[model samples]
Target: MARQTASQSTLNTDPVEQSPAESQTSQEAKKAPAKKPAAKAPAKRAASKTSSKTAAKPAAKAPAKPAAKAPQMKDEAAKADAVSTAAPAPKPAAEKKSLARRKRPRKAPATGPVTIGRSGFTKLKNISEIRHYLRTSDTPVFFVGATAFNLLGLDRWVRGFSYISYYDSWDGTHPRVFCPKDKPYVEFESGEQINNWLLRNHEVRAHIERRTPPGKRPQVVMVFFDEETERICEELDYELILPSHALRERLDSKIVTTQIADSVGVPSVPNVLTTVKDWDELVKVTNKAKLGQDLVIQTAYGDSGKTTYFVTSEAEFAAIADEVVGVEIKVMKRINNRPIAIEAVNTRHGTVVGPCMTEITGHADLTPYRGGWAGNEMFPTVLDDESRHAAVQLVRKLGDRLGKEGYRGFFEVDVLLDTDTGDVYLGELNPRVSGASAITNVTAGAYADVPLFAFHLLEYSGIDFEIDVDEINARWEELASEDEWSHMVIKHTTNSVERIDAAPRTGRYVLDHFGNLVYSHGDLDWHLLTNESEAFFLRIYPEGEYRWKGADLGILVTKAHLENSHGGLTLHAKYLIDAIRGMYRTTLIEGDEPQPKPAPAKGK
Candidate 1:
């Protein structure tokens, strides 16, 4: 296998950098300064310069000085001096108007449809206006990926919204999904390759062109994209709604996330960022930091389940020495922890957080890798009031800090709840649309208001809007305890490869009296699922496809918790897993037989 390029491997992007157009405006603002009112009062001129500097630096900490103490005659004299200087060099009315225009803030161009043309777009003042704009506008928006799992039902909210995917999960029946017919077998190593292939395909290009108007650039979005993806979008003249790929690569580093969290007062698990050559150095580093004997080691990049190591002794360290030696890693003290997953969107207004969900990981029946994320569970009483509040604050602070770094869109973060201490610490940061988004968008809060993703789209929509983020957060917090939902990503857990002869269909399933899962009927998405008995299964590998260890078979979304009060799989959850796996019939691929093609990468 060839080495993976940075573009193919990167999984994160940021929220704090200014937009390109905003940066250009800031530079132009600095170029022209208002003329000094008076030359006589050098002290006043110095004070004015200080004020300008303060305005330029949003994070400036300098305290403002009190107004100058001057007698009535002195104030009048200064005013007379200013009038004299201005009277001598009075500018033309046209020049005065131009300067005033330049001084005023420049409005950004509309990212969605421009109803007002050069005059600018109508600012969406409230949630009602935002919902109306999205529903009524005909702007072309496409979510390009291998499958529409992360954002499956978003088309119902936004007009002209379509999904351009490589896999026909809906068997070409869904109206909003576009899967090209020219797809040939290709062993893709990453989601980036799958997206690139779809973008370059003739049929996909034609599909996009057919829907797009003349001289308009259709919008393209994906769960995973890179520099190559950006280049393709540029070549094809499509607007990729994401941050710069370079920024993503930088923030993808675990070390960078830790540092940023420290600066913003977001607590992380006690850890040290360093390079270790062998077990001795590893011990020495941990000893100095007072990290316990049990440690969690993580490489700067890669799937955490595959790259992260748990070591308690020299023997354990020696086993993975080849991969960890001389490499920069984050080593932390291991603790009894329960991981929580939450999604948030960092916007110009503020970071709007979603409901917190308990992560289901390391299930032997669901995944072969330990610590591998299998699914997420959300329920009204899953979390106590204290844990939920602390988790929300951590995510909100982290999002605000990232926004300061110029990242202004969607991102997911893992918060580790120390079961022993009840403390919530920042875990891994996934600076992209994550697997948990499916649950995040359908919570009671989302139904009452808008989905958390609506804020992300608003940021990129180029329309000015304002809302009380605190109010939204407060409402979401209250509503989180009023709903129960769960979804699991079921993968092939066996070691050997096999060819699937028959598989479950992509639709709703109900359990029969004999404890079997029966396909109820065809459905577009899981939004309409009514009860826990009915589960929506979205298949990734249909009949005649190959399944290997860790290969995703399908996703099951249903109401109620898949996990129990004791943090174990419930009987119904076990039944659903067994029944679903029983539905697939596969034959083992023995030695000497050709190996099966690899599936496209799924976003975690």
Candidate 2:
């Protein structure tokens, strides 16, 4: 799921007494109602302070109840109880049935739209209204994930926004980020595992329960989740605001994506889906499709370059036979292509597409695998005008089809540009917010209107909205042509199990005249980065963590293109990688080292 950020002052100005359930009525109120005098301001201040403290404190800290703040706590508790039992309001029958089917527990049904501030009941008709609603919303939204990189800048746009992250990128200094301090040694095999572990942690749960307002369920979003995540969210009553895990899993499969694309008239690379038990069967399938001797085979699921296989000779197939044999694989003719990633949202209005970016993949200096996704670059001319239009159209079609298939919210598609034929082929679908979102949310379109993910929120926000999808797309295309942005995910590449004694801080770093990278300043997000000389680095494996082979070290964001037109690392990109790597210092764990030989010295 994609999260959004709004300004804090607007959000903290006045509390909306309306619940999400109460925001459905379309009635207009009578005019000439004089505004009442403002209520005591101290109470509001106290509540804000309490909420901020709870949100900023480390999860491991014991819940504090200072005597000086006791009265404020009591006031908050009273307000919560009052809101919960206020009334049993009426709601639209259809909306009632929908909420009931969702199995969400609420105190009452809403009869009419509650007035917000002194604005009375007004419908959200434009992007500006939507932005105002989000900024002023007091809803507690928790984006739980491995790290907060994908949705890092969201808090800036939404009040009461916070990130529950497993990786403490800010070392607990970030006011909106909360990472638990007591993590035990556990081998995490996937992003889901990390999220589940964080969800189950006592401190994390306490943090969520503490900041959530009374009579309101907290909203949770993540890039990777499963049924276990759903159950955990249910146990805590945190609204998992994304498509069902089962639906996402089904759509996540490469085979399923191909079928959906085909159904919507979106072209994928010439391919055949079949179970390959041996090299002979693979050959037969490829030959029947006329895919020739060289082919690319992919399993239903995997990340980066792990599950994708490329083969030409029997020897090459033999090495990965164990993985492909008896498994359903997508076999395609290998093409000389440039990989592109585009993010889109399935909104009630329609599907909204983000900028198309050139994918930086498999650079040995950045990643260990041949086809691994290391980063992405977003700039004008990534594709010609015609090709860009085609790619956007294809993504919109896929997103619309996904909505028809009972899936909604944020999704990313990998499209391959056939250099020979100028064709755009759907490569795969990531049915969730991905690493590419860092650039997607901060593009020229986002500044002019809103990020693609905000539309995802509107779909779930239960508020009616209208947009000219074509106009937005055309304007975004023009703005994207003038915008330049790039980001790289740096991973620990050495085959060693070492503990990080010191790691680079998560903030802006500038390249000095001597080419040395130095800390520029502390910042919460990279939107403040003004030039290529300065980059915002979000650290993943902080000090005291084990840095193993292929472990993510951090992420680097800049305005410069990291890869050239030929798909090789630019010289400046290489320099940035070396300088960033030089910031980390690690020492081998004691148990992993050889024992000393004292006996030989004594005998001599």
Candidate 3:
């Protein structure tokens, strides 16, 4: 079939399919070309103008029939708009699903009409079967790909069903999936021309597009990423799942997950993985194996503890032992730590757990990689009770052995318990989404319906999934010991400065001019601000204006995400100086106005 319509017109880009459920499918309507509507050329006959009463003024028209109808005018105007993007008024079916738990009964609440993010939070009813999960693969595309996930409203689950990305862009408008504005605009200017325009645009691929069962066509196209993804799938073909390349090749030897945590008995950091390549045979193997008593070397790819060194003298190993050559360091013993963190889910129906976080790494060096993220606190006594039952049986036995090795999605493991031998080691394994998944997607067990990412997208979404992970961990440990709510990831201490520049006129009430609404996070997630149009900016903080060294200053959901002073790294640097001293300073209102928008935590 003409090589399958030139391989479905170069579906966005391709290449990367190791099977994993054929990557999910939807090659965007053959690279979105449907434009041919403005071609009526030959009408330029104004070459020789005329005046003489307009060339003897054409013989007066409207001369018969309609003479008396000229007085009929009933207009009645009612249309005003400067920039209207309305689409948030549906979602009533008993709050959209799970009046508590229905194996099958919801028929409302999806407000199916309005939308946003991965299509209105995946249609409510237990994520509305991911809107009928591709009715059995491919051809359900709707990705306009502009971003801001329609400002995080997720376009009512992406206009419910059907999506493929770049619907038609450069604002010319044709986006059933949204791509307007010169379609891919030079394929986004760089990253090698967006990987050569998604492998020369095989019609924006999801295996050449077809929609589903009716005729059959989804070969595959799943893409889930976070962090570097090597120039966005260099030269593209598709098939990507990057939990930082399996955390840099199976946690790139955290002494091989500490020898897979001593062959799955998990408990670490009293380590030693020496390899004296130089630095004078690593200083005689740290003085004949006494191994720097209270040390920590770890080079081969370090994060949050910066190439993990800490010699403690020899002038800190002579100003850092020639930067540990032949890398492979691992020399631990630096205890007195307590992170915890958790969010597993590797299912075919099994590894589904959530409540256990405890990070807040004191922003290691103020921010960015050096900032061991100083904010996280999911109660439940951080860990103890046999180290939270041996760290939830070591991440449900490492997510049931990564779902028998096929590896499912949404990962997060981090251990380290030892508050006096409550010994539970396994420190890291974020397959993805582990900055503590917004503490399990806005908890209260996702407003009482249970959405720790809808059980990690219903584990591979072939459904049939069951729950009762010890009855949702004893109903989220009896509703987190009766509502405690806590979250904090405040990284942005100064990027783009604005602790209070001045401005807040539009409907005026974000406080400051003595009012108090000086919080942040767009218009309203907590206080509900939307007058001039709410989104001042602060939920996950991704709009702009940032600084204070650089990187991360967005998470701060509260309620005791961590108690006791000095715990989650100086309480996230004193919770960013109590959210920059609760922003507050309004009543100025000038040209680009903007200011008054802080209000986090919440009011009863």
Candidate 4:
């Protein structure tokens, strides 16, 4: 790739130093004044003639005081005046200018967006222009979060792109990622807390400050953040390039998502929203709404399926009664369904949708939670053409509605495809970049044009550009249909919390013809995986971290699907999982330790 030149408007070029001849001449002038006055006696007559001649020689070298001795120079000069009993001559105009220049501090370089005229702005209207803009941009863009997995390969496309992560998946070999030095352990309760900790870390803040251009503010993107994150970024002068935290929090609610979907003509599952205090209240609401006895109950907020409840009988409701009594819940009639996840960006032009893929969720071998998301599969036939079109329309509608609600940037939507009825219904909303982004960015569509995320970046880049959403979406859909990709997020599924003594490296691992998994080579991401025999593993919890149940161990990306038609793990997938799990070596923790509760059984 050709090296891009820095923007002239934002770059600061240092001033050239004085030549040796000039320095020598300035030194001679300064010494001449001190020597001429030294020989004069304490006289009754004023030495006007001698002072005039000394001032004419120009005291240029007077500015060359040693930085370490600057403070004492004024005091020394005062004492010399008291002893000599003769006043020092004033400096000439030219010499005074030189001294003033040396004393002034250098101005900081211009940063942030460059000022562009109407004509210059006209050039940035397409992907090629936008790509060039980013390549030459000196502004630093940071992806701050737990792992760099969401935007791993973005640095290759845009200059000044980097990652500030909590986990060092690359073991310090990857040049772009920055991890802070060790600090006292503080138990974190959420992704938001982890991110907040990183932003407030002294080492992390210093790292960002060093990389940041003198006057430019850093740009930050993360998978999760809250108001506290907003405050930290504000304190550090970082520009958080996403929707406002207040707006995101509102949209993150499952109840709010369902309401928004209804307003946009997008259908959610046949459900009723209400608080159920007991089994009798739940039954009454379901009967009044005509929902059947079998239902899926979901709290407004929770990760994966942890908050999702499968209630068929009084026994199941009693078990989870404590969780749902006061919270607003979405009670829906259970349907035979397949889960699909799609990522989209709500741009100024319109909503840009990426490829739709099947979600791998709740495999006991991979996760302890019954409905926990494991991975995703992208292939030509994941959905039929008609069904695929319907899904796209539904997602675009939701995206447009979200845009109207003052929400923009990247978001993931889960859609349930009813196997019996062939209807697509809104599942839930993740108001940020998701695990699926790894596969989404490497698709053939990204090759033909840019990744879906490129559009998101452009929205935050403060550049005005034009794009036809229909045309782009159509081309992406065609490209995605021909691409085959799949990835599994391997988690520590055991009940015990053990510290990992040794862990596998992050790179390519292949399965030989004899079924033995071997290390192929060290690579950054799974974008280069050529065949199903090989897989790319991004190790998350490296050596020395506690491996508790449901904690992410690593992510395995393969060229083939890992699930069967019935949504069960395939034999090949199981083989890969078992082989990868065997590579980890962990020691059990001593004394009292936290143990995860068993997850609920899978629902039909």
Candidate 5:
């Protein structure tokens, strides 16, 4: 039987209170005869400082109160009781009648019509105002994607937030997860297609219609979306909260990213951008930039690790002739560098940055492709003070530049740190929600303020608000060293297709005395994960599903580092990886077997 980890009430805990000014306005709005407040409104506004408090301190247990205060505490308590027990003098008959009249019950106030965004409202001035606005909002918001890996746990920050996914990672238990029942075994080529499929599903359409009221369009967000996604959203009367696909496509190119960085005074690795049809031209271009023969060549689009090629000789160049010949590509000199990734949001006020994390790539035990992104590790020592500060500046400059180009919302950038010189250079750009967001939202800074993605949602929320980007960035930088977190994306590392007869369930697990993984219990997410010994595993392809090379098997998250200083998997990480892989029972498919096909097209 599927177990429910967190109930709706527990997961929807509100961590906001109105500012003094707003509180006064709200109090007046309640008592006004034109718009009376609900009878239960006062209870809904009760204070719960569970997440809002001083966050500069480390995440250790709170310090115990001093013993000397015990007697004073008792005397204070006694005086409070004495004052409460004291009786009041009798009132005159006229005054008593007036008091009775004021205490009579009144009818509840009627709700006003829903407004998109925060139209016609005062601009927000600080984090407290921003938090209170989002907490009380009723606009329907949906995250549509292949999986909820990117923006999971964001529902805690925003009201009326939920997810619509193609993969059922929650095993039909999570209250907020909605997966269509008409799933057919189609080999999806990209995440965009998966999102398009979900948008067109009949069950998904009905679900959205049920929650959405008349004359209101639901707000939709996704990690990977294209023109087709925009068109489908238009047909369904839903709002796609992102920049145009054309702008994103242009900025997605590595060459374009390099040029933009250059224009904005951000440095990139020494390289030249040109069309190289042969080895001779490539050598000429590299020599022009004073780059050595050992080079990294990347095409205009696609991630560098997946599409980038290393060339030191003519033979190496010939290996990727089809992809490189006559196409615009970036050829850079190889350097001893450490890759770092950081996420930021370009808001109307300015750019707000998140923590810097080291990227984990190309571990043989984790992934099949070379230099493929396996996971990310975020700790205090991930970067020195100088390098970390430089990365934040680079991201801020890039975000400001993108804002000028009419692009805004969430984006991730790759920053290359030269281990030899301690200099930081800008890398590629991801103009949407990224895989690293899973760790970004759970950091100490996020708990103190709001998750980075909340700002992205605010951009599309249609509310007029303002924030001090510099203040937020400074506070986050100081709190960076107060938390430690890491996650590894376990993929099918073999070159064959197999059927999973037995697979581990998605939930919490603990290691026993022998360092073996043991199931502890089910969980809603990694937010409540406590120690290094406990891990939360989210399964992608569950039991009885087909697994292929390079396919994601699952994700393992804990409160410790998974990679060492030498950029390799730690011993404990290996143990967990091996144990999880050991539980999978799969059988290879014989040759000449046809692959699974999609269900018949509707009306065909």
Candidate 6:
């Protein structure tokens, strides 16, 4: 790989320091004035020539203070340093008082998006408005961790932006702030816990003393799933409106999703619903539904194909039954369908769906399950018109229902198109702004909702809004299908349990040899460092006092694939994960402790 010249923001930038010779010259200049007077005092030795010029006045002149004082000052400074460090039991109270009285200058006030670490950016926009907003506002922002970050992208956009949003980068040390300054203090503990604390008591009592005045508090936008964001809002006496929360909860449930799909005239796979208490009844229902010998089960509201399951025997079902107690389970006929999912955005105007995505699956651990997932590829051979219409119908119906429920943001509805049968089924519906929302934001069909999810927050907040959903959807349709966009969130099939290492901080961006940029995450957190095609590390340690471990969460990539090249029943999807994992080095470990790093050579 070619090594490019380091940019100014890179670690290679150097700072200049004064040379020793320059220091000596400066020191000598201070002594010159004192020496001038000391030399004049020599008139006493030459008193016999006193009548010349003004030399007679020198006889009554004072001694040269400047030259005499210079040495004394230097000696005093040296003594002070020695005293401060060397004195173990005794020290002058006056010297200590003088030292403490020199107040330090406040650092440069950063006002804008936050950049991770000590990185500098090329340019920034919205400086004036954001600065005005911050300077005058009394509202406080809390920060949390575990950003929706996969790349260091967030560090670029959010480094100088605002008050902490309750939790910092989902990936690293602290809740990062762009508006005020980079606050590396948020990295301690879990981002989930910080957000939860806010929820539990509208204020972060331990760290801060007061709340942002009610009128000035900013709307909280939820880009990731954490139980506490809502709770904190309620406690603080602030309006915590995540429009997606209400709508997604309704549409997110499998039964609710299937029903909505049917209302919109979309068909689904044959399935039966089961609760925690009714395995036997579920069996009876499946038998009555007449699914087949092959079956698939789904736990409601999960991501990256974790909620999905395939079963062929009593034992397989039994293992899941034990783990997923009290959760709603959806059992369906195992159909030989090619897996395809799409990103959709439902604004106040209407719902706009992105290009089709084909999920990558089939790792050995998931062979028993068969369709185990690795990632998703967009532009997986376009779905036929019939299936496309079905997808539109499903999303539109859900969007309308969401409007009634006060949800107006970016959400993704998963559509499963059966290749063998030419049928469509609503596979999953993520009610909240989903992992695919970023793709939708940049689509030509979509107007720049570059900050799309924020609109959802506005709807639930005290703010009033009206949007032209139809226009947005039409525009979205044009852009969404024209170019293919894809994204995949990486997960560990063999998950660890022990907490090791530190958090992978978010809010930074990276590019490939092809020059494609990868964003940190939907939330600001974590950064992936890659110097070459093969050398990459997802640096996750955030500032502060918390510990992080597990199948170390790392980078996520969204790359375009050839049209219709990704869809398949099982064989095609299997290698994507193994291939992604192979691109970098990560060692699996027992439990939540961080993945073990390789030991360096003994003699090197």
Error of 1 at 216 (Å): 3.1
Q: Each model's TM-score?
A: 0.78, 0.80, 0.26, 0.78, 0.78, 0.56
For model 1, residues 1-604, the per-residue Cα lDDT tens digits are 1110011010001112222321110000111112211111111111111000000001101111112211001110000001010112344676434322112222465486555223234677777666667666666788886677777777767665778866566776667777776544453434555676788777777778777755456888766566667766766677898877667656766778889999988998899999988899999999999997788887666342545678999999999897678878889888777778888999998899999987776677765656656677788776689999999999999999998888889887888888788888888776777777788888888877778887888788776788789998999998998888888877766555555677888898876676567889988788877788789988776565555555677788999568766767887888788777867776655323544543322211
Global fold similarity of model 5 (TM-score): 0.78
Residue lDDT tens for model 4, 1-604: 1000000000111112223321110000111111111111111111111100000011011112222211100000000000111223554676434322111233355485544222244447776666666556777788976667777777766666778876777776666777775544443434555677788776777777777776567799976666667766765668899998768767877788899898878998899999877899989999999998888887766445556777899999999887788778889888888788888999998999999988776789976657756677899999888888899989999999999999889988888888888998898887777777878888888867777888888898766788889999998888888999998777666555455677889899887666677788888667667888889888776665545555677778889778887668888888888778878876555323544433222211
Positional deviation of residue 534's Cα in model 2 after best superposition, in angstroms: 1.0
Candidate 6 displacement at residue 473 in angstroms: 1.6
lDDT of 6: 0.38
For candidate 2, the per-residue lDDT at 119 reads: 26
Best by TM-score: 2
For candidate 6, give the lDDT of residue 577.
29
Cα lDDT, model 1, residue 38: 19
For model 5, how does the per-residue alpha-carbon lDDT over 497-565 read when each residue is reduced to its tens digit?
A: 555667887789887676667778877678888788888887766665555555577788888778876
> At residue 431, what lDDT does model 4 achieve?
76
TM-score, candidate number 2: 0.80
* Clash pairs (backbone) in predicted model 2: 5-154, 5-157, 5-158, 6-156, 6-157, 6-158
Instruction: Show model 3 residue runs off by greater than 4 Å.
Output: 1-208, 211-294, 299-385, 390-409, 417-420, 429-471, 475-604
Off by over 4 Å in 1: 1-121, 591-604
Q: Please provide, for model 3 over 1-604, each residue's C-alpha lDDT reduced to its tens digit, 9 standing for 90 to 100.
A: 0000000000111111223333232222122122211211111111111100000001011011122111110100000000011223543665433122212222354454534233333233432344333222232332222111111222222222222333111121112232212232231211112222332344444333322333322222112222222333332322232333434345433555566656656666566677666556666666666655456676543333334565655567667666666556666655666666667666565776776766654443333323234345566555545566667778888777656555666666667765555567776454544334544544555445444644554453333534556666656645543444444433333313222232121111232443233443222222122232121222211111112222233333444434464442444334433544354342221222445556543321
Output the TM-score of candidate 1: 0.78
